[model samples]
Target: MSLFNIFNVSASGMSAQSVRLNTTASNLANANSVASSAGETYRARQPVFAAEMAKANQGQVGTGVQIKGIVESDKPMLKEYMPDHPMADKEGFIYKPNVNVMEEMANMISASRSYQMNVQVADAAKSMLQQTLRIGKS
Candidate 1:
């Protein structure tokens, strides 16, 4: 792999993590939303990522990461009995989003760490390039 490919790899990683963070935030934001009907309930969303590889002389080499798509969780929404709630259904139950606050918090932390690692990789690559340029000055 070429040294320049490091930047591309790190950039893709950062982009993927950004999408993950956004989706996690959205899930957290809707965690408390109540719906009168199951169909109207919000489902937790997650981003799917795939590895991009390139054909090289030796073999397939990793290029970077790509976001395949965002998928909604199939887990059942929370059903709570709140007779006095304005959004309660005919059965005195309200449907809450399937989002788990703790899980979303964990995802947020993981995504943040991945983003930071990618930034470090890019910085290291930049420093290496700068050092390579200075090698000729001596």
Candidate 2:
């Protein structure tokens, strides 16, 4: 791949990491949310990423990534019994979002690191390009 292609690849990676971060943020925000019923309960969400084959291979210069979809967690919610809880149901049980805070925090950290790595990749590519241009000057 050409040096220029590195930017595209890194850009795609950054985009993917951004989606991951957003999902983690959403999960964290709803971590303490409660619902009276399963249907109304917030579910943890995650983004589904797929290779951008068309962008990566088109004209023999395929390198970009794309987001496929965002998926809701199928895991069951945590039911807590708190009679004093205002949001509790008739049984004094409240349904919390299925998201696990620790898992989401880990995901957030991973996404952040991935984003930083992509930025570093882009910066390195830029430096390489600059050095290549210097060769022309010489």
Worst 10 residues of 1 by lDDT: 53-62
lDDT of each: 0.92, 0.90
- Candidate 2 backbone clash number: 3
Cα lDDT tens digits for candidate 2, 49-82: 8888876466656467789989999999899888
Question: Which candidate tops lDDT?
Answer: 1
Off by over 4 Å in 2: 56-62
Model 1 earns a TM-score of 0.94
lDDT of 1 by residue, 1-138 (tens): 667988888999999999999999999999999999989999999999987744343374647897999999999989999999999999999999999999999999999999999999999999998999899788
Q: In model 1, which regions exceed 4 Å deviation?
A: 54-60
